[model samples]
Target: MTDTTALSQTETVQSKADVVQVTALTGSIGAAISGVRLTNINDDQFVAIRTAFHEYCMLVFRDQFLSVEEHVAFTARWGEFGFNKMSPQLDDYPMVLPLSNRGKSKAVTENWHYDSTFMTEPPAITTLSARDIPVGGDTMWSNQYLAYETLSPGLKAMLAGVRAEFTGTRLAKLYGLDQVPRCLHPVVRTHPETGRKALYIGKPGDTVPRFEGMTPTESEPLLRFLYEHSAQPDHIYRHQWRNGDLVMWDNRCTMHYAVHDYGNEMRELHRVTISGDRPV
Candidate 1:
């Protein structure tokens, strides 16, 4: 099939057990599934949805036109949500976080990094729904599992006991550290649920002084190398969002960046995070 026509297949509605699994991109960590809607999901249907999310690490539901209240209600089924401290649009629905690069608010994630990893306890899962889609505004998510597993075994072994601080303010400064976050996380993190090892290195400006006992100069190059390699093209999936498209991802195993090529066109999205006990 032609590249453009590949994902053009009409999504078919079906029963929960008969859900269709269609790849959004050739080798990405996410899948666009058909046959279900989140707004009025049943227990069994949600189970299947959660299963798909765990296996794929990310899941996208298309053409699901839902109201703000309905979207927030649906995401709450996954877990408790958080408010967006920097965005004022979340004023109405305190539980939902608004991600907008419009007249009123700036985009929350314009760089590559995991969501809220700077916090002592980061979000476990995040569900984002598009309210408006402007040209050139896309979101890209990277599979950290694949990124970590692809490294040479020797390198993996070297990173076994390593750790680094992940500060949010520093990451925001990549465009300039003018206004950045301050917090720390391990350089190598163990997934709370999956128990798999992942490289949790740089996020824009997160400075890596050292890994365990290494010197700053000694560790900088290696950390930088991994940070660059982890977001390779092969492990990435760039989604061109549409209004009503809902994308959910496991923050424990993924990093995302927003594409801001759409200069003036307004784009808005809402995110609800699922709380986890803690990072393992």
Candidate 2:
């Protein structure tokens, strides 16, 4: 197979499972899968999908168009559901969170972030089902593995034992809340599954603010550098949304940006997350 649209076969265990194909979308982070439907996935298919999920931090299932119930059922196979604390879930089902352009407050997701990072135990996986995509509402994801791996030896060594304060400031404002959640997480965290390290900082004073025990003024420069360095073009993939698209990413190893260029045009997505343990 050629390298443009599909992945060259490798000696991975998933190759032994079934005919399901895992095609790498970008050189860095994502892959597209085919052959097995999420609604009727078999044990062998599930094994193949799960293997790809670990090997590639993000998986894009084009034209899946899963219903809210089906989306919840698929997420259940990964782990316990990670509920949103700020936004109310879709009507009756508390596990399905809705993000629509009509919801003015949903703009908080426009920034680059991992889901629920302020929580002591942030989510591991986040699944989004796209609908009514406008012309320019594309989303971009970056590989944190590259962010950590490409850092200078000196910088990586400096960040080894440091922790930073992650806060829900921007989200709190969107939700009209007073008390935002905050927690300290290692500046460089190891992904429990892949055992790869990632830079855990986001937009400095916004999502994360200062290193633990240091004043914001002191931690400003380095934190800013890491955030800026992490999104270099080679390590990123900008996903143009399509109707009925399903994208699931490992929150532990990737950070995503939701573009707000759609203006007044309509865009809708339902999100489901799988709970993860505290970062190591």
Candidate 3:
């Protein structure tokens, strides 16, 4: 007689490898997922994908070049789609926002940041679907959970109950917006799902003005350290995007940098963010 218990375990492991294969792209943050298509995935596969997204903080699905409509549809499964204030939305699909390098002197995403932090409720999961790819417009993501974990416990204790100011000054200037938007968020935010703490420092002197009323002089040294430390090379994974890649990251626990070494060539991408609650 077949040992059904051992047989079931073997089948389960095989099924997982068959359904989706997630390979870590870096020791710290991003993972590449194969054997599944975003446009054509079942609920069980999606659950596995979401689990992988949270575990790795970012998931890169290669060759998913989904249509604009299809991209919006797949992302909507996560939650309500947030409006992207930086660009004009597609006429048919309001959620489809473009991130093209067609008319800009510099890309706003060159620095590391959490998306839409100026809002009280910034989006949680941000998915970017590659439209057009230049040779060197790679993006990098860092794990903020590791950033906070690796910090000295003394510093962690000191940051308790600390809040920082987040602004859109640089991005607003890049887009020629009239007024910059800003908000206050905890310095160390706890993830709602995983219960892990993540350092929420923004680009110093840019988005993060100062630790709430502590003055620039008081906050500069520590804020700069946190910012610099959170983005250490060992804490990051850089993605050299392919023509059909679809990458998604958790904004609550990751900071991503968009590198623009490709000049004057067409580099386009579409992004949709799922609304997240206020950081506790």
Best by the TM-score measure = 2
Residue ranges of candidate 1 with Cα displaced over 4 Å: 1-24, 84-89, 102-108, 170-181, 207-216
Clash number for model 2?
0
Candidates' C-alpha lDDT? 0.71, 0.85, 0.85
- 202-280 in candidate 1: lDDT tens per residue? 5433444456555666777887788888799877889989898988898888888887888777788887887765555
Give the per-residue lDDT of model 3 (tens digit) for 136-182: 99999999998988888799899999999999887788779899998
| RMSD to the hidden true structure, all candidates | 5.3, 3.6, 6.2
- lDDT (tens digit, per residue) of candidate 2 on 1-280: 3212223443334544567878887777788888768898888888888888887789899989888888889889999998886888888789898888854446887877888889999999999998678898899999888889888889989898999999999878877888988999997899997888888888888888899989999999998899988898877889998988889999999999998887788888899999999987
Q: Output the worst ten-in-a-row residue range by lDDT, candidate 3.
A: 4-13
The regions of model 3 sitting more than 4 angstroms off are 1-18, 102-104
In angstroms, give how far residue 169 of model 3 lies from its true place: 0.4
Give me the overall lDDT of model 1: 0.71
Candidate closer to the true structure by TM-score (higher is better), 1 or 3: 3
The superposed Cα distance between candidate 2 and the true structure at residue 203, in angstroms, equals 0.4
